[model samples]
Target chain A: MINRPEPILMKGNEALAEGAIRAGCRFFAGYPITPQNEIPEYMARRMPEVGGVFVQAESEVAAINMVYGAAGAGVRAMTSSSSPGISLKQEGISYLAGAELPAVIANVVRGGPGLGGIQPAQSDYYQATRGGGHGDYRTPVLAPASVQEMYDFAGLAFDIADRYRNPVLILADGALGQMMEPVLLDATPREVLNVPKPWATTGMKDRAQNLINSIYLDPDELEQHNLNIQKKYRRIEQQEVRYEIILGDDADFFLVAYGTTARVCKDVALKARAKGMRVGLIRPITLWPFPSQVFDDLLEGKGNRQLKGSPKPFGFLTVEMSFGQMVDDVRLSVNGRAPVYFYGRTGGIVPSPREVLAEVEKIYAGGAGKPEKAGN
Target chain B: MTYEMLFAGFGGQGIMLMGTLLAYAGMIEGKKVSWIPSYGPEMRGGTANCSVVVSDEDVGCPIVTEPSVLVVMNEPSLQKFYNTVARPGNVFVNTSIIDPHHPALARLVGENGERKSQKEKGGGRAVMSENVSATEDESVIAGEGVRVFKIDANRIAQDLGNGRAANMVMLGTIREVTNVVEMASLESALQKAISKRHRDLMEINLKALHTGAEWVRSHDVPLLTPAG
Candidate 1:
């Protein structure tokens, strides 16, 4: 383990960069983009100091490919971009997943369908967890709410990527990337990772030349590869459903959210509790795993008998900084056991706590959320 | 206690710097801080502003819909945010650059102080008359009760040989009025926020802080006595 430095205040972007460096991320390739530009800026200055590599690639596509190259050489590598930039890297990310290469991609996402505004938005939930580019693939997406989480997740993304032999993502947004806060950055150096990858494509001098290509002309071989990836994903879903329950027990209703939206919902829950409303909150840390069991547990209770001071157990309100993406997962988890409702703000517009509370009140009063388009 | 403040001014007025320094000072005080800069085309020459929240507990969303304190360094900034300052909050209005006699301003002293010509009095309390008519915006501001500390922050900074230090003057006033962060920690934050090349201005900036705090102390003037 390395020395833990004194706690320093930093923007979320800078913290992620420092976390990557601390996690022994020796290679970083990324293009310059707003909100998340600080990641590349920090890496450019610090990577060389640690005898690592940092490149401001020509574009997002080139930058992601650079990450693929570095990861192929069995080195800790990373790349970061905002929404549009992440969109551009999806093809490369899909390839990374197919090849079973381990790499970290930090998506400090912004509002978007195409080159959307730079303000924070969690609209990329579907793009991140359900596969954005092509084919059968899933990226383990970790959402960070605070600057501290941004730092910790940067390292954790790399560790999980290597451990699972998959591409991992730090799925934060512009708010989490731009907002500044105090972060404790000391402890648990990257040497503890110590992931052995003899199968990695290093030099062929002492061992068999490892092939690192996604293209499998044989249909049966490709199908087998996909089945293997799916099996690993199932394992991840079973073992890595990280979430936090805020005042969940004995509460009447819950606000389901993630990342910055979760922070806002926490305020709403607290304010509602102050007003004698039994409101609780659920924050999903791993977006890819989706924490369906958490939802299932909350929805299932003694039938017909509601808890005191609360609505039905399954009557949960999903608040997202997007136009209702995660609510689909929430609804799926409930599966008619309990009612699921949603409130969201898209196009870089953040929902205030007051508005979210108002929506939750509506839900508690038997309002049903109009389900949106539900395909991947 | 959580203190949410908005520091606003022209693009070059060091408004963002003031907010950053406050957030950093909050960190020095062992408090949780979130600094959210208003990022858009509006920040160029328009009203550049940033919201800073210093809290003992974990901070929620960083955006300040209604700030508890406001440092308005320009007329546009004042006009833009006066209505959004929460009642019972504090406002430090920069009288140097803004027209105190501006018809729409809800001057703090007009109700209690003697009305004098703008030429005779450097401050603008005459607009307190609007507090009577109470336009919707003005009603939200003065009618709701706010301690308005009208200071010639620009003039004070100029007197200190750096007109740009007006933001610092406003910051000092915030420190005195809200006591959101410790004075010594603010000074340390100032040193860290300023670059080595501008280390020479550290003393003058500290002077600006003292200058603003002194102005607030002497204002024995009604900083807003919350409306009953």
Candidate 2:
């Protein structure tokens, strides 16, 4: 019997560790960095307790390569780091993505325009959502708003990685990494994950030789590989889109945000309603699959019938800490169905509730007059 | 009612422990609770702070901008957090090495709606005591509304066989004054929250908490009535 408590206080990194362990992650390899050190620390202690393998590699680059090795073995593997450290691991990540290996990589981001302060920052929004690793490829990103989501999504990340045969990124910030919240800690049983391993490097004795390689010198062969990966991505786009809706039924304006930024939007949505503004929030849980359909459904009207001259009462406002990363995705999702707007605070500064409320007031008071360009 | 607090001090002063204990106590009482500590470079020696939120309903945002209560163990922490306290809130100050005149001093208002400057009350350069003492005599005379409880957390911790446990003592005092959680529940939570390696130190810390609570009770520390 699994005894699950309602809520238990936990740091975001610690929660991630628990979630990864429960998700049948048997191997973790990573070097330690500030703001995300707890993840590796927790994994080091807990992995052994669960009869798993935990290796603190010499560097982030080596750790990511180790993840590459483990993932080739068709075992659930993971690694974590800050922005600078993540920068170093980009090469390995690109290789993993190319190889079509399932693995989880957590970027508990801190400030960085080249090793900026260790304070929490959303500067990595562009890197995470836009694919930091070198490739004409994309990785599914999950942004968790609270510690509980941190725990829940870590497990989900591993599952999605395996199902899609792609590297999954948990794009969390220092605030989430350092922050602790009550989280129900129930280990998802290992038997629940019936992972198939036709390609695993588990020694080919009674089976065909398994090959896990990203390099394909023949142009046609590489093209075929790319085609297969693109098809998988397309399927992912069709089937996997996750988001949280807050008071959307009566909303005239929709606030779009993710991760810690979404939490602030939730507060503003409440205050705006109290002040008689019909505002709501669409918090994207999965950033890569982008929840484009949700945006389309909201803007184009749910059913086939359009409300005559109602003109889609909802206007999409993208709120992020970066200047305009997620806003581009929101615009693409809306695809001219409705006007898309944006509000952001850069360089490690989080907007206050009052600031967000003021933005809502401005938007309501003839501020969203000019339609924002598609990719701004 | 929801109460959010930020306890800040030097790295070794038990600031994080204080916030954890409050969170544990809130959990024991079935209230939603969160404790987020400072991580990375800022946590080494520069400064350390932790945010603790206890609420009746689900806590939407754990990051606190205007905390109802602020606890400072040093001058830097006092300067850093004083402006973030909500008006009509309480602040606890540790006045051992921190002279009230240190440029990072916090502004406190007494009961009579007048600002009681710490420097003026502490006589510009009051001899820094090894024990915690309230230098806010001017606030008492002026009747400013803000409550400032000063304590020598170091002295309390030493008496408890570990100066680091002063944070727990301060948490006990805050609980007693605020009635945020029951004293027994807080102590039990504290026992569970502390690592097993430090299980032997739990009794002394609990004793320290009780001592601090008794002090608050005996002194009749005025509680901040909840905001309407």
Q: Using Cα atoms with residue i matched to residue i, what is each candidate's TM-score against the true structure?
A: 0.91, 0.88
For model 2, residues A1-376, the per-residue Cα lDDT tens digits are 2446556777899999988988889999999888899999999889998899999999999999999999999889999999899999899989998999999999987777898767676778777776688876778899998888898899889988988889999999888888887788774353435668688899979988888889999999999988998898888888777888877776778899888888889888888999998787889888888888766666667652222223355577788777778888888888877778788876667777777778778778866557574222
Which docking band does candidate 2 fall into?
A: medium
TM-score of 2: 0.88
Consecutive 10-residue window with the lowest summed lDDT within model 1 chain A: A302-311
Instruction: Give the TM-score of chain A, superposed on the true chain A, for all candidates in the order listed.
Output: 0.93, 0.93
* Predicted structure with the largest lDDT when compared to the true one: 1
Tens-digit per-residue lDDT, A76-161, candidate 1: 99999999999999999999999889999998888888888988899888999997779999989999999999988888888899
Error of 2 at B83 (Å): 1.8
The stretch of ten residues in a row with the least summed lDDT in candidate 1 chain B is B132-141
Write down the lDDT of every candidate, Cα atoms only.
0.82, 0.78
